[model samples]
Target: MTTATRSTGDDERSAGNDDRPAGRAGARGVLSAYLALTKPRVIELLLITTIPAMFLAERGIPSLLLVLVTLVGGAMAAGSANTLNCVADSDIDAVMDRTKSRPLVSYRVPRTHALVFGVVLSVASFAVLWAGANLLAAALALSATLFYVFIYTLVLKRRTSQNIVWGGAAGCMPVLVGWAAVSGTVEWPAVVMFAVVFLWTPPHFWSLAMKYRADYERAGVPMLPVVATPRQVSARILVYTWATVASTLLLIPVTSWIYVGCAVVIGAAFLVMAQRLHQGVRRGRGVNPMRLFHLSNSYLSVLFLALAVDAAIGLPVLG
Candidate 1:
């Protein structure tokens, strides 16, 4: 779901590096435009959480082929949802400084073509997941796509400041899809990991939103930072950051000292950074939200990587 525009959805900003107009360029340029529509970096972040869930479910390495299939299907599902968001949000994207380079806004590709591409990817994701994994996995992947497109993009985004909080649940579905791919059902440990990402989404996006508060304000999007004070926003980030760390510990029942050790250290760093941001905002000193923004990305990456490694080495703390 990228916080659900990452379209996390961190506005799923454009994959293209610069805002230079594409202007219906050649085949390679056209191809790149389509790729940008998928929001590859955000998809990459979503998948980072996915594989570790599979590892945790299997309690070790899953079949490499299963990992491959799930990643492909999950990427397609996320891609379809993100592309459709581009079509729906192109108006605000054109107005927003952070998103002006996106494919739909830039006219590098036709809107109708991007829409078709999105729908096709969803269908393909279902087929691939159904055939290669289980129907449950396929269904969960499709549901995430539908929720992100219909609920988050169309319904809640412009209407509420708490938009990303609820909308980000769609982004958490990859963990469900991953766990279901291996075990064929959702379990509590999987649910805890889902909670971690769900909680992680807000602070992650809001930090970036702090960096681009004016863009959101200009587009009339009621992002928390746009509507709330910097201190208020950072306070909320601290709350979510604390909850994210607590959720990581919930995996304690299923994980070993390895995972526990990593979670504690990384989570401490997350809190330190978050607290620093909060203190800075409170004091009206120079606060770089982007520092926490970049750190949050690395934090989730390291947390999930530790989970995968803990699963791989087969060191469980409990039965």
Candidate 2:
């Protein structure tokens, strides 16, 4: 899901409906506006990491009902974070072309309502996880929401070029939530999965930042591409891409050759794409960093899917 290459944690996707309506039309428009606030696409990306983590922890399929409940809790948690992020970033959203139409910027939704809604969603996520999954999962889910809202949105986002690097930790919590849901604790494999997402976040986000460099510059967000040269940005992307691929291989001790084979083929593709991006940036010819951005999404999804599939098949390389 990379998203929620889904979002950079700094900038969320904006989908806004027109305002200036009243009656039933107003009600529908408001509903749609609220939905956009949640960043549903971002939630889906987080979920992609989640269920697979469950599979790996279970070493096979987990209970269907448990999966269903965890998904609900996780989605609500992600939504809470995204909604609060919109509230916090509305000022910049108004400035960035891509986010100008966001509900908050467009006045389709009120900041106060969005704030209350975000809080409600967080509470609901905690209640759902605690009742349906476990306390550990619930606590982790709520902690992720808080981190995204407080640390990413309020603390680092506008102040640093490295915002996404540290902020991306919130996104990695789903793996912990998933693993804890299954095994009731975090273990080495879960941390390995977390590292994969943590390493992957910057490249995925920076590519988009490169594509939207002017928007961030105008908004004064200090994203790496807005603050650094293209060559430097692409260089770091290559380094993180290398780390991402290596992190995937860290699971080899607990996974089968099938996982290893998938990692090799797909990791090669990821590195090759990142290298091309670097070379293109270095050469000064027009470069399409977005190619690597889109591939980052697929790279994370496929890597985690391999984790799930290898676990479900019960084939082990070590022991």
Candidate 3:
């Protein structure tokens, strides 16, 4: 009887040892999968717009603590929206080559778990913004998430070719939120920044759509590149590119000489790239949409960086 009991205890100990490693690995995978649901790269881009708007609102850098709080709140809010978007779009994501490797598609995280995780983050985001920033900032952050989930993901994305153009408004909310966080209100400059992003979105996304046209076609997303001919799409891209450049110049009167100079130089480069894409598409030449797509990312980053720099040291250009 004693020997049999010992054998059973030894078997239990062995089972515990075996289960420990599996538990650790499972925990690690769960953590990684949750992080992927946040879409960190997209969060980075969203925070880029938010930070500079804060600087422009403060007319220099805001306090480090404020910056940290706003960034955390913005990230959580964006992550929440992106996570829910993944859940909603999982059906389409399953078929697209580019998206088939997502956490939901791979089934590393269950749908219900991801949904609950997103809800938790969204609530945390609102609480953080309200506690650390203010009511307006929190409201703006929540609105961005709602607009992204409902307006962009559910309502617009699948139905219309002009989906991105209208849907991009949600992406513009970070600038407004940042401005409100610093100043407790939105202003004309914030509106201009919002417009710049709104204009920049189509060309930015269309380039990716152009590269993944077949993916979108397969998914039935009706992206501009999917619905329009290459020349037509490129032409629209050029129009928006020029409009974005012109919108940046509007900042000259509100900002400074440094911002004006940077705007002119960067806008010139952006317009040139757009022109090249348009000409190439028209001529049936080697048109790399990704080139303009990549440049657009650089363009926005540098432009916002310039805004921050000008706010720090630039003299008045309108004088």
Candidate 4:
């Protein structure tokens, strides 16, 4: 071949290799963006609550298929809700460091595309739960999605400091949905499970809100930390933590002594952490509050997982 032709071919080959990496990177980026829209951390906590609720509802092994369907449906519904939230909050999200990189906020994904994806997933999740699980579970899931997307995100989030307090109902519904998916009914035990999560939400969220009060202030969203003085937020966190610990103990009557024991230990630890956070905030120290926030996340996961393990071992939680 001519030297010129050889040089051109080599350059073309090099360019192809360069383009390949960029193409692969772009594909990976798209996947990461979509997964972020699902808000996997939120979904994980939601599923943790659902699993314990199922075990508390049925003392024995529940249908694995039903559990599987409920998980998938819940995940899809949650993802859709979160995606729509991002779409709705894109304006404010752009200004918040924690949320600035979200697909909708960053324009990595177009708002219209995200809207369509959210709608499709939301509808599909409801249909899947209805077909693969049961009508009650499906309806509950749908209600939760609507509550988060409309009530929490679009309405309460930007309007009031009580946002997490009332908005928490949406997060709490997964327990009812999971329970009904298995037994096709709601009962006191399910209600107890719901209450545990409902109460847990406020303190859990408030901790993070405290850490990001400035961002919330900048966004003009009335999160508790943004509206309340630090002392007030800390006081409320301790109050809610106390309530959560109490609710955890209430499960003792409905679940196994093993679960009750686990609850006591975890709840005590949670209280200690919360109390420290309160003290730190009172003293004008912010670091421990963030530590408490991280601990709270782990606390709920371990606490619920303990219940699931106890149930699986055939411990007499329901009896």
Candidate 5:
């Protein structure tokens, strides 16, 4: 009897050990789904604009602790907005090939879980920003979230072809938040930065819309490319691209020569790409919209990186 009991106990322990890996995998899947709901790539772009805004606000490296706090809070706020967007768009996402693999579309995560997670993150974001930065920063972050969820996701997206144009306002809020975190007030430079992002958004997103034209059409979402010809969309993209470059130049009066040099060089490269895109679409060449789309990503990233670098090391022309 004693020998039989020992063998059974050993078998139970072996089974328990075998279940451990499965448990770990399950945990990992849940974490991954939650992260996916946050739209991390978009969050990354938001942060790219954010940290540099802080640098520009201070005209140098801001306090390390303050930067950390603001980033953590900002990330949470963006994540919350994205998660709610996922929830709201899950129906269209399921039908669109590009978004079909999203966590909500795939049913990997339930709606309730995603909703709760977003709310929790939003509350946490407000708490962190208020505690670490200021009430103004916290308010700005929350306003961005509300604008994205209510205006962009709910009203404008389904109602108009100009959805992304107006919807892009939410994305610009990060600069304000970063600036407020540093100076506790919105100022002229911050407004210029906001305009740069706002002007940049139409072209950047329209390029993506051009790439996913069919996807948007299938989902009945009237992205610019869905409602207009590629040539028309490309032309508008070029217009926005030029406006974005001009907006960046607006900062030169307040910034350093390094920033001005970068703005001119980077703006030239961006215009070259945009002009090529326009020429190709107009001529009926099979130009991949993703080429311009990818370039836009680099354009914004490098431009902001120049901003941060100039803030830290370059001499100011105005001062």
Candidate 6:
């Protein structure tokens, strides 16, 4: 071929190769973005509460299928809520370091697409839980979704420092959903489990807010740490930590000694970490507070797991 012809041919070939990888990467990015919208970590935490709640509500092994269905429904419902939250907060998210790369904010996914996906997922979750589990479970899941999407994200998130405190109720509903899934009704033990998670949410999220207060402030999100001084936030953390511990211990009346012991030890360690975070803030240090945050995560997971184990061993502490 002539020189120009060969150059043109090479350009075409290079363009073809470039297009192939770009297309593949684009597809992968879309898939990953969609999954990110699900808030998998949040769903995992929510699901952790489910198994324990089921155990606390059952004398014998609960229906494995019902547990599975409730988990799936809860995951989908929570994911949908998170996705819609992202869409609604896209503007603020774009300004915050922690949320800057979220699909809605980064334009990795369109707002309309995310909104539609969220609606579809929410509807499907309700259908699945209602048909596969029970109406009570489905209604609770639906209510949780609405609370997160509307009450938490829309009304409370920007309005007050106590946003997560009230919004946390949405997060705690999964325990009731799980319990009702098998028992078809709520019980005192399930209420205790709900209280445990309800009280746990504030300290868990407040520590994270402490670590990212600057981003929250810049985004005008009104998180507790952003609205309050570091010392004030730290004090709140300590207070909430105490409340969380107390609530977890209250589960002893409804759970086995194994769970109670786990809660006490974990709660004590959590309090220590919170105290350390408080001291750091008091001293004008800008520490990450990861110890408190990480410990809180572990505390919840292990506490619920203990309940599951107690159930598996054919023991019912309260029932």
**Per-residue alpha-carbon lDDT of model 4 for 1-319, expressed as tens digits?**
6546678778889789899999999999988888888789998889888887787667766888878999999999888888888888999999999899898877788789889989999999999999998999999999998999889998899899999999999998889988898889999878887888888989999999988888999999999989889899989999999998898777776667778788888899999988888888778875556778888899889988887877777765444
14: Cα error in model 5, Å: 5.9
For candidate 6, give the lDDT.
0.87
Candidate 3 residue lDDT tens string, 110-164 = 9999999899999999999999999999999999999999999999999999999
Q: Number of clashing residue pairs in every model?
A: 13, 3, 0, 2, 0, 0
Top lDDT model: 1
True lDDT of residue 243, candidate 6 = 89
* Cα RMSD, model 4: 2.5
lDDT of 2 by residue, 1-319 (tens): 6424556543432322223344569789889999999999889889999999999999899999999999999999999999999999999999999999999999999999999999999999999999999999999999999999899999999999999999999999999999999999999999999999999999999999999999999999999998899999999999999999998888888889988999999999999999999999898889888899899999888988888898889985663
The sequence of per-residue lDDT tens digits that candidate 1 reaches over residues 7-113 is: 42233245352233444456668889999999999999999999999999999999999999999999999999999999999999999988999998888989999
Which candidate do you rate higher for lDDT, 1 or 2?
A: 1
Provide the lowest-lDDT 10-residue window in model 5. Answer: 1-10
- Per-residue CA lDDT of candidate 5, range 220-302, in tens? 99999999988899999999999999889888776788888888998999999999999998888988878888988899999
Q: Whole-model lDDT, candidate 2?
A: 0.93
- Candidate 6, after superposition: displacement of residue 84 in Å? 0.6
Q: Model 6, 1-319: lDDT tens per residue?
A: 6646678768889789899999999999999999998888988989899887887688556888888898889898898888888888889989988888888877888889999999999999999999999999999999999999899999999999899999999999999999999989998878888888888898899888888989989988889888788889888889988988887776666667777777778878988888888898888887677678888999999988888887777655753
Clash count, candidate 6: 0
Against the reference, the lDDT scores of all candidates come to 0.94, 0.93, 0.92, 0.87, 0.93, 0.87
RMSD of 6: 2.6
Q: What lDDT does model 5 reach? A: 0.93
- Stretches > 4 Å off in candidate 2: 1-25
Rank order (by TM-score, best first): 5, 4, 3, 6, 1, 2
lDDT of 2 at 33: 100
Assess every candidate by TM-score.
Answer: 0.92, 0.91, 0.92, 0.95, 0.95, 0.92
